[model samples]
Target: MLSRTPKMLLQTPGARRGFHSIMSSLVPMVLEQSPRGERVFDIYSRLLKERIVFVHGPVNDDMASLVTAQLLFLESENPDKDVYMYINSPGGIVSSGLAIYDTMQYIQPKVNTLCMGQAASMGSLLLAGGAPGCRSALPNARIMIHQPSGGAQGMASDIAIQAEEIIKLRTRLNGLYASHTGKPLKVIEQAMDRDLFMDPREAQEFGIVDSIIANRKAPQSSGKQ
Candidate 1:
């Protein structure tokens, strides 16, 4: 379902040492389960009811559709509230992540992304789209950024067209990262030329993340979104 039941929401277990780590492991599975079991206190159920969206697997067309729909729904329902997105994907198709990233940018509300596990490749591109100061990752989470690639074969003309398209795609990706991180396009391009694996600390230092999530407590933030 694109929308969650309003009554099905549950509060997240507040900060305990290693709470994020624990949730990081369990949430992806828990959130997938239906409301058959105890639904009231179900963390996953609650997350859906709130403004939380989970990206637990690959970023493909299906994944992209779900996230974009949820973000659009959340923004329409409450334009002032923030949208909390947790990503734990190995990454997938470039255009899939781009759709979600574009949706996040188009929304009036601030979209916050949490790297709970492996946010690599196209996943990092999605993470980079979060509104300023809203991008964060768990202390032990891993993040990566890299150039996009694809293959094509047919006539020589087809191969040439594919090559030109890939080049354009790389340039677009470079511009996206540079705009988000305030880094030079050359710097972002160099980092992406090879797979760049980073922990939360390095990701923050590299401008991929703005904060290291210490806790989940939120007290009605507003304005500067």
Candidate 2:
């Protein structure tokens, strides 16, 4: 499991300005190595081989951008291995979600998603992008799906453009559901219209996931041969 150093800062653009100032004011810390003694290592050094990256928080453009970058880095570093994504998001911007989905699909890694909390709206779509043998949620986790939503300003033509974009987003989302559930497109569309929400068991029953992995163990190989 790969571990990364935690860096905390308020995520919103307005809030980040204060964090930037605070960081700039701090003097950097420096530590010197002992040059003459036997070498010593810390826990992080001993645990470098097994790493699990944690990407927890709201789904926004900044988060999406960072996730995409990390996915690219992981793909480059480990081209043949599966990348586990533990998602617990209440969902956010549709476009941001699409950006993440596109990156995940393009990387083509076997993505195993563990939905520990909630995977709703756009988050559900991202979960659906996982590879065929991907794992699913813990017992209490939930997954939800619905039509795309957006806000608009300005003229009537702008509204029309936004509407068209929403339609396209819905079509893309429906396609994902259809592929994952092996359901007809029309049926998936109807389900999306219903604003479907399912717990782990229900989701698994409907073919939304392979199984409910409550123990959080490594996903077993499906042995498709």
Candidate 3:
């Protein structure tokens, strides 16, 4: 019995070329690993061709750079297609998260952000920042939002400047959340005063997610949602 060829291999010529490029990049890794690496490489290539991006770790400079590049590349490849971003992060540096968020907004393609586990702090902001009506969370996913946190250790004058900057970041982030969720700025600010956590349903109510994904009877046939 012959194994079935991947759908990507059967799609448009463009997809085949994209898949080939993905495989080419993974060749070095495949050469250095066991057979399992091949399997991993295959899955990763499929995901890339499917236009799925993952954010499964902390939001840092490296993650920002890679994700930004992927978003731009996908947009260049097909500006009309929707991009899927699956996020499961505890959140990290504000600057790094902003870089990704800015790119998401800058791209022509609609970004469908799916929360798999927890989207907290800056992570929650990114979740809310997805294209309107495209943000979603799994049934058991949790979401959180809070004011940006930072520490300052220096002379009184320098510490004061740092404190001012932190306040500015908090204000900017609060404004963004309010704009995305259509909530009052004061309401968003109050919610962010502490670590406010919510499940999928609550996140929907809070406007962090437009919907909670339900079980599908069949595999997803399109990237619209």
Among the numbered candidates, top TM-score falls to: 3
Compare candidates 2 and 3 on lDDT and give the better one: 3
Q: What clash pairs does model 2 have?
A: 1-50, 1-51, 1-52, 2-51, 2-52
Residue-level lDDT tens digits of model 1 in 139-198 = 779887877777666667767877787788888889999998889988998988877889
Sliding window of 10 residues with minimal summed lDDT for model 2: 5-14
RMSD of each: 11.1, 9.6, 14.2
lDDT of 2 by residue, 1-225 (tens): 433322211122222222123324644443335667555444322222232333344566676776787777778878777777777766776666778878878885677667778777767776767776585777788888777666655567766776776677778778987988788999888888856889877777666767677474754232134
lDDT (Cα atoms) of all candidates against the true structure: 0.75, 0.65, 0.77
User: If ranked by lDDT, best first, what sequence of candidates would result?
Assistant: 3, 1, 2
TM values, all candidates: 0.77, 0.73, 0.78
Q: Which residue segments of model 3 deviate by more than 4 Å?
A: 1-42, 217-225
List the candidate 1 regions with Cα displacement exceeding 4 Å: 1-45, 217-225
lDDT of 3: 0.77
- Candidate 3 C-alpha lDDT tens digits along 106-209: 99999999999888877888899999988988888888887876666656776677778788888899899999999999999899888788998788888888
Model 2 lDDT on a 0 to 1 scale: 0.65
